[model samples]
Structures are given as C-alpha cells and as structure tokens.
Target chain A: MTVTTTRLRGVEAAPEADTVPLGRRRRWREDAVEAVLFAAGFVSILTTGAIVVVLGKDALHFFRNPDVSLVDFLTGTVWQPQLGKFGLLPLLNATLMVSGIAMVVALPIGLSIAVYLSEYATPAVRNRLKPTLEILAGVPTVIYGYFALTFVTPILRWALGARTVDIYNVLSAGLVVGILVIPLVASMSEDALQAVPRALREAAYGLGATRLETSLQVVVPSALSGIAAAFMLAMSRAIGETMVVAIAAGAGPRLTANPLRSAETMTGYISRISGGDLSYNSVDYDSIFAIGLALFVITLGLNILSGRIVRRFREVYE
Target chain B: MTALAPGSIGLATSDAARQVARRHRVGRAGLAVFQLSTIVGIVVLGALLYNIANEAAGLVAYEHKTDPAAVLPGGRDLAALSAPELAAVLTANLSPGEVATLEREAPLAERSQAELRRLVDERVLETHAAAAWNLTDSVLDRPAIEATVAERHPDADLRLTSWLSPAFVTAPQSGDAEYAGIRTAILGSLWVIVITMAVAVPVGVAAGIYLEEYADHTRWLNRAIQTNISNLAGVPSIIYGMLGLAVFVRALEPLSSGGAFGAADPTTANGRTILSAGLTMALLILPLIIINAQEAIRAVPSSLREASFGLGATRWQTIRHHVLPGALPGILTGTILAMSRAIGETAPLIVVGMSTYITFDPSSPFDKFTTLPGQIYQWTARPQPEFHHIAAAASVVLLVLLVALNASAIYGRNRAQVRY
Candidate 1:
C-alpha cells in the first residue's frame, strides 16, 4: 500500500508537460510497434499452414483418384505415372540409390577433411582452407549439374569402359552431389569436433596417446552424434537434389539398384514433369504433389530424428 | 611411463617400446591421410573453377554468308547502327513482300532496339557457320582447329570471339548460338529478386526481432515456433517448389496472377508469373534469412538494452532506436546472402514455371520470365556442342554476380565489426 501511494504521489507531482499527451502517444506507439512485430512473427506460422494444407489437399486427390491404387504405389516396381502406374518403388529406390552412393563417396572424405581441419591444421591454414571449401558449397546446384554432365560423366566413362556407363548414369550425379555435400559434412562435423572440450584431448595426450588416436578414439566418439547428424543431413540433401539428377541421372524411371544405369529420383521426376505443360488437376499434375508429400515426410522425419539425437547426446558432454 | 620401460617388458629388445613406436608411425600415417583428403577437396574446387574457365574463353572462325559491305554503308559494325537505321537497311535489302512477312512475324515497331538489331543479324546475314570449337579445343589444339578451318573453308574469315562479350550481356535468348544473349534472363532475375527482397527482408527481420527480443521462453507455443523455423531451414528447396505450385499457382492464382487486382493480362492469366516465382523463392530462403537475422540480433549486447531501460526508454523505443541500428548491418549481410541464393536458384523457379526460352524482358510482376540459371539449363539441354560453350559463358556471368553479392556481404560484415 505504501509503494502504491508513493508511485501515485510521484505521478501527481510530475509536470503536466511530461505526463499528459506525449506519454499517452508513446504508449500507443509502443503497442502499435509490438503488434506489427507480432504479425511478422505470425507469417512464418502461416507459411507452414499453407504448405500443410496445400500438400494435404492435393495429396488426398491423388490417393482418391480411381486410377491410382495405394497398393501399387507402395509395392509395385514400375513408376510410369502418366500410364496410371503410380508405383513409388522406382522413384524411392532411385533416390535411395543416389543417396547411398553419395554417402559412400562423401562420408570418408568429408570426415577426413573435418578431422584435418579440427585436429591437424594450424589456425592460419584452417582459416584459409575453410572458405575455399565453402566456395565449393556456395556454387549453385545448377552449375554442379552441368559439371556432372559435361565433365564427371565423361571421365567416369573413360575410366571404366563406355559401354558399362550410360551417358546419364546415377554414378556421376551421385559423385558430383557427394562433392557438393563434402563441405556441408566437413563443416558440420568440424563444428562437432571443435565442440569436444579441450580438456578431454589433453587428458588423452597426457596418457601418451598420439594425436590421431586422441582424435579418433576420444574426440570423435565424443562427437559421434553430431557426425551422425551430419551424415543424415547430407543424405537428406542428396535425396532432395533436383538439377543434378535431372541433368545427369537420366529421366528414365528404372527401378534397378545399379548406379551405372540411369534412374529418376523423386526430385528429378518432379522437375522433369513440372516443366511440361500439364493441365491442372490431371493425374500427372496431382501425382507430383503426392511424390512431394512423400519427400517432405521422409526429409522431415530424418531431420527431426537427427535433431533429437544431437540434442539428447549434447547434454552428456556439455 | 614405467609401463613402457625396457626392463618391464619380457623381451630383451623391449617389445613395448617398439609397439609404441609402431603406433606412433600409424598415427603419423593417419594424419597424412587426413591431410591428403583435405587437399583432395581443395583440388576438386580448383578443378571445377578450371573447367568452367576453360569453357568460357576460346577462339572461333566464322564465315559470314552475306558480306557486311553488301548490307551496310561503308562496311560498318552491325552494332554501330541504331534500330531505325537497321530497319531501313533491312527495308532496302529485302523485297517488299519479304519485309511485310518479317514485320508480321514480330512487329518491327513493337520490338526493342536490341531485338531489331538481332533480327537484322538473323535475316540479312543468313549466318550458317555452325561448327565452333570450345575454349579447351581452341587453345590446346589450336593447330588442329586452324587446320580444320583452313581445309574446310578457305574463304571463311577467322577471328577469335569471346562468348561473353558486351553483346552477350545485352542480347536475349535465341535459337542461334552466335546471337543468344542473357539480357532478358538478367532482367527477369532482377525483377524476381526485387520482389523476393521486398517480401523476405522485412518479414525475416521482424521475425528475428520477435524471436530474439520478445519471445517468452516459458511458453510452449514460442518453443514450437522456434522448432518449426529451424526445421523449415532444413527442408529441401524442391519441396518448396511443390508448395509453391499448389499454393501460389493453383490455390492463390487470383492474387499471384494479379487477377484480383484487375491488373493481369487476359491472355496470360496463368498464375505462373514472376510474382509467383518470386514468392516461391522468398519462401525457400525465408528460414535462412530468419536464422541469420536471429543470430545477428542475438549478438547485440544486453548492456545496451539495460542502459536504455535505465534511461526510462520503453522496450519498443529501446529496440527501435538502438538494437535495430546495431543489428542493421548484420541483417543486411544475411539478407544479401539469401538474395544471392534466390538469384542462382533454378529448380524451384522451373517448377513454378520459369520459361526455358523467354526472349522478351519481363515488364511487370505478372509477366512470364526466365533466369540466368534457367537459360544455362536450357542451353545445356540442347544437342549442339556450341550451346555448351555458351552455357559455360553464362555460368561465368552467374559466378561473377555471386562473387559481387558475396563481396558486398563481406563488406557489410566488416563495417559491422568496426561499429561494434
């Protein structure tokens, strides 16, 4: 009661010039600014809503269409969407094949690069080399697509006889995509390795462990979850990449697992088909959304799972 | 240390010490391998740049079907003449019926000066010298190329041509490789980027402010929002293209097509316009901008806020006058980087209906458009080898634009560093 009375007395004693019109206007302006800021924050939520609703509604149409059977979409091998064979196996397998190849190529090299950056290089070398790798990362995917088509594929064919490799094989695309993701994997894993407390490395070193041993056994295992997250994220990137596969991985919807042959990924399918003039609400048009829904769910699940693992394991070291 | 003693080992040769030395060697080898892998990455980056640059510059020998002396007065450069002057030349050269047919195909009066110039080059010149050497062949196998040119066409005029000349920048897309330019694509990209910036910058900055400054940590809703934004960042760009097709192209066609505003062209009422493409790109880069802006805003010192509060400044006043100015440079840096990504992006725009062969400049948001990357993609898809050389030249242009954008971002960051 005494505090309230003192505040009231202070306000009463304040000059009218300070307390009346300007104070009210200032308060009003503050509220307005906050409201505007709040609206800005709300737009992101609105975008999420739009994505969900749009994908959901169109995907429902695709499933409900008489021509498409959920059974075929899940289990069948062929994927000629225009012919009413909406089997997702071909597309999914191709996506997995490409991602698998990308992982095989990128994992060792990217980790090695990260290991060198974190445990081996001097500060100056690290600073100079990190941005050089970033230049690779920042080059547009379309350019990478061209590089795969014009350079990598010919090199592959020349290395291993031309007959074994089609002009637009998944091998070249996957390899180029791997090169693209190397920087991502390297940088993320580097951050994870760096986050390993210095004391742990010193403890291993004091026990006469070599730098490689400390980095591999002590530092790396401590940062294993982050490394795994990097792998998952890179795989997600590989699966969703469009231009490289569209340009180099060929447009054929082959269900084969051979990376030497051309196959269409989910993203490649969407890019190729969407470029065509499909009438609205057509099966082919609606099918793109269904495929997109699948991509969204897979990537979303991988990201969330990786994020959870990273968070759950982070506490152990922190 | 005693564990490694020679006497502690059962062998006279001290097996323990030898084992330690072997392990050390293994470790050294492992480090060498890691260093080699890093070198591999650098080498790959170097090779990519080399390959692109190899294709960007070269020698070319062209044989003109019609002599310039026959077409123009005093054998002047085709580019030296204005649109009207070129049109007059065409009128004097072609028969009256042929002139009428040419004008009907693309009204001469409606065409831009650049378009008129291209028309004269295409029709009057009848240039059919199709075989071209790439940068690699032209330089490394110069003797071979010269031999082929000399043997094949003794009358052919030989001159080294830069694929990326001033004419290349100003010319629009064309069927002929020699005449194709990136002017339309550049303008389209600029238009799309302008809309992207308009939509993304303000919203992204505001979202960052709210998240960093006003969000209540204890609220589950705010936490959910935070999680959603991060997840959105990891979402692949092509999926955003799908979202754009569903929402912008089909669902919100009225607004995206400008139909609701009564500003849309009746014949081109389709929602696949620059506006839809820009909004889609804006969505794709929104999370990136938001995350970067949040980091920038969060980096602002807390003491400034405290000092403002101590000075009787309200939270809004403190943020408006102090926090924003402090964060502006950082925000600008992030925004520019996001813009760079949006500019180079091709997949989402293709899915959202960027034409592969738009020859005219996009005058409004509702006009159809193509980007530099789209043009490159189109050119690469062609069967002709000459198209690949031009595509390489186009990639060079795109890379230069990216570098310029990144340089500005770096400059902004440096300025921010000085201010802080």
Candidate 2:
C-alpha cells in the first residue's frame, strides 16, 4: 500500500517537476557570484588592454607628426626634443650601460649568495639571513636614489677623483641600482637553487666531491636554466628602474659607453619629460609615450622569455 | 673492471695527495668567497641606512635675517609665548602688506601657537641654514665643521639639528628647508593608500578566487587571463604610469577630478588628483595581490572543501565559509606587502602629476597631493644642500613605515604557517 501511494505521488510530482524550481534560486545565485568573480578576474585583462591601447594611440600620434619620423626615432643618435631631434640611441645606450653595470655587479655576488644559501648554510642561518635579504629588497627605490646621489656619488668622486667622475655619473647610479637589485637576484636565484633536487647533491657527495664542487658542478649545472631566467628577469627590472637612474644618472641624453660620464636612460628620460610642464598634445608630450611604448615592448619581451624559460625549467625538474 | 689503463690507479701517490690538498684549499677559498658575497648585500644595506642617518641629523649654522630676540618684546623666549603674543609678534615684525596677505589667507589670531611660530620663522625671522654638517662630521670632526662655519658664516649661530624631530614631523612644507616638514605628505600618503586598499583588496581577492576556484583549465579565456596577469606582473611600473596618465588623468578627467560629484576643487579641477593616483596604484598592485591570493587559496587543503561539499554546500558557500577563513592570514600578508609597495611608489604618482610643493593636507581624494617618496624625490632633486638633509629625514620616515609593514607581513606569514 505504501509503495503504491509513493508511486502515485511521484507520478503526480513528475508532471509538475519540469515547471517547478529545483534549487533554481541557488543555482542563479551561484552563477551570479561566479560572474562577479569572473569580472574581477577579467579586470586584469582589461588593464593590459588599456595599457596597450593608451600607449599605442599616443605612440601612433607621436609617429604621425610630420616632424617625427619613425626611422629617426629609432636610428638617430640624438634625443634632443628641443631641436626636434628624436633619436632613441642615446637613451637606449645609457639604459644598456646602466643595466650592464648592474649585471656586472649583481651576477657574481647574487649567484654566490644563492650557492652559499642553498648548499652551505644551516637552516637556522638561512632563516635569519633570508629576512635580512628581504629587508634589503623591501627598501624603496627612491631611497636608493637618494643614496646614489648623496652617498655613492660622493664616494665615487673621492675614490676616482672629482675630475674623473662627474657629480651625476652612470657609474654611481648603476652601482646603487646594482645594490638595489642584489636582493632581487639573490632571492630569485636562491629559489631556483633550492628547487634543485637533493639527490643530485648526494650523488656528487657519493663521488667524494667537495661541497663547493658539488654546488658549482652538479647542482648549479642542473639549475642553470632557472638561474638564467632569474638573470633575465633582473636585467629587465634594471632596465625599467626609474628613480635611481633619474636621480644619479644625469638628465642629458648622450650616446656614450663611458660609465663615469652622466647620461640619461629611457626611463629617466620619460620621468624627466613627464615631470616637466609640457602642454597637452604637443610632440614633446606624446614622445614620452613613444618611448614608453618602446620600454613596454622591451620589458614585456624579456619577461615573456623569462617566463618561458622558467616554465621549461619547471617541466624538466617536475 | 677488466685491464684498466696503467696510470688510472695512481691515487695514493704524493702527487695525488698534493692535488687533494690543493682541491681542499680551493674549496675552502671558494666557500669564503661565497660567504663574503652573501655578506656584501647585508653590508650594503647597512651602509645605506648609515648614510641616510648621517645626512638626517647634524649640526646646522643658522643666519637669521632678523633675530627672534629683536622681534620680541623684552626679548622674551619664543617658546613661552602664548598664541596671541605670537600673533602680535608676527604682526609687528612682518611688513604691513605681508600681514594683510597673511590675514587674507587666514586670521593670525585664530591660528595655533605652532602655526604662528612657523609664520614668524618664515616671514619675520627668516632663519636660513647658512651651513650644515653631516652627523659623522658633526660628531667626529666637530672642530673642523665649526671652523668652517665660523670662516664662512661669521654672523651665523651654530646648533645641533635633528631633522627628524617632532617639530619637523608636525610642521608643513616651506620654501625654506629650515621649516619644511612631512605632515602634508604623510596625510596625502594615508589618503591615497586608503583608496588603494579599498579598491584593490576585494577585487584582487575575488580575482584570485575566480582563478583558483571557478576557472576551468580547458577554457582558453581563463588561460589567457592567467597569462595576462603574469605578464602584467612583470610590466615596468612606469608603463602603468603612462596608462594612468592617459586613462585616469586625461580620459576620465571628470570622474577622477570629482567633477562628476560636484566636489571638485576649482583650483585643481583636472584629473591629477589623489583619486587618480590611488586608482593607478591599485592597478599597479592588483596583479601582485592576485598572484599572492591565488597561492594562498591554493594552499587550502582539499579535504576542507570536500567536507563542505559533503554537507551539501554550494561552491560559493564552501569558499565563503571554509576556504576564506583559512586563507585570511596569507591574504593579509599579501595586502600588507602591496600596501608597502604602493606607499613607496613614486614614479607613477610623479607621472600622474603629484605636486612637488603641495603644502595643504589632502582632505579628500580629489585634492592635489604629494607623498613622502615624491617629496623626497623633489627635495633630493633640489640643488640646496639643506633640502637633501630633510630628504634624508623623510627617507628615514618612509623606511620606518615600510619596516613596520614588512614586519607585520612576516608576522602574519608566521601565523599562517602555524595554523596549517
């Protein structure tokens, strides 16, 4: 009798079930929440789109100006906007000089620190030292700019003589920038080194190899791709760093390789130009966007390449 | 194992022994070099702090255009005077035209003692730093500094000045370095950061949730969003500045300037307001926050979610009740870090047109403003040696704020670790 009644009720419920709401409100709410979350996630993509659109539009406007030729902007050696010379070489050269100096100073020290931290230090020592390195990393770059201008510049002048070093030389700026990037390089390289499997180290030790030899030969070689990615990322950062170079690397655009001479970088030039009172829609005003577009492209390419290398490295290890 | 080369088994020879010893020596040397390389970063950090400290405190030689005693009645002490007395002193000492101008700006009688005192110093006494020595020189080579001051600024009165004193913190900026302070800059930073946090925290967390919880790996749009965020993380900060300039400062001028709300300051009705700066900073740190929050959420054990689902909880309910609480500490850590980064950022704000000489506190998001880092950059760019000293003091303040923020982040991370 109970089974017959339940079957009669189910037959009655089945007829209206298609029209009845079965947690439809809850499902609608869930979809709404997911949509909101998706919108939030989509904002990042919107930001990228906005950046590309804004930079591309202004850069196009800059290039379209009859006085500003794309060829001259890229290939010319001069960057004097006052004389209608929009050459990018001077700024690009200074950027390379500063970044090169930074790499020169950071690479060996940062890698060595990584090797020591991963292979040599006890866990306790690692715990204590890691935060110190982070503190170094957390320092504001504007402070580094101040240090570059007042402290590093004066010391360079005293060491290399006042005449040999200009008050605002790329050497001082680059050296301080190197110091600013040291913790970055060290931490990233350390992450890569720490990711190397311990079995590789044991294998080297099993062969009666010294710790240094194992680190330098077995472990570092295995982690080479990760290390290279770190280097590339750091290089990109140094290229994009603004305040330190703006403060100590001088304000003039000069195409020179001498580290002692003051020269402006692309970032520094953008900063200098934007800081001034340039009227809207002027060639000078739009030129900064063109330079910014170049900066964006270069850094983005390097970052994408670094990400690829890192992904490949992860695949190899995982 | 079969017949090997004859010279391969010569391991116990004296030459081999020497080779082993040399290798050991090289290993020791390399260890030392690597250790030293590690120490170099710490040493550089130490030197940087020391350098800033050296510049922030020192002996200063002041040359007053009119001595404070000359402006006061019976040469009374300036500190002991009442606000009214200070106002009287200002009125008596300043030119009639200057007094009228001051009254037009604000009534002197209504001003606080500190305000009156600042006015007296700025207009009446004009106490300029004729010479300054760094802390190192002041302590170690006092006699030389004194001698140099005496030789160069004979009429100057010499005294020790800590540029980061309470008076300096309370005072507003001035054209003269002797009276410039970071009070306005601090307020501006607070206002900007508040707006940044309000916008970034929820949106960033939601984005993280979407990516970690709702995103399907098979979907190309989700993958593109993921890739785009990572790329955005690596984009140069200055590029963000350009975006802010084009979008916030120009394209959305009406909204950013508060003109849409009819709250815009007529003097600063353009888009280069704190709102624009804060929004730009939010975008700048959004990717960072998203990445961190995703990691935190991903670390939440799957068992918790499984249990929530077993209880018939929906995906949103599971996240809201079970996962979010577990990830809160990690999210807090990331938020603090992003805050510190935004606070220290100067380039984007500069491009967004932070006023270098803004003296008034930012009362709302629509006001023109400067931040500590922006003020430091401006002062450091100044040709005056005195400005550099104050810039160092401002740097010290900024560093302390960052250290506090970072310490809290570390503390939060530790708590998160203990929980799981």
In the range A13-43, model 2's lDDT, one tens digit per residue, is 7767778775442355798899999999999
Candidate 1 residue A265 Cα shift, in angstroms, is 0.9
Interface RMSD of each: 1.0, 0.6
lDDT by residue for model 2 (B61-105), tens: 988899767787788866688999999888777789989998998
- Each model's DockQ? 0.67, 0.78
Number of the top-ranking candidate, with TM-score as the measure:
2
**How would you encode candidate 1's per-residue C-alpha lDDT over A40-114 as one tens digit per residue?**
877778878877787788888999999888788889888886677889999999898888888888999999999
lDDT of each: 0.85, 0.90
Q: For model 1, which pairs clash?
A: none
Q: All candidates: CA RMSD in angstroms?
A: 5.2, 5.0
How many steric overlaps are in each model, in order?
A: 0, 0
Top model by lDDT, which number? 2
What is each candidate's fraction of native interface contacts (fnat)? 0.66, 0.85
Once superposed on the true structure, which residue ranges of model 1 sit more than 4 Å away at CA? A1-26, A315-318, B1-13, B61-121, B149-158, B418-420
Clashing pairs in 2: none
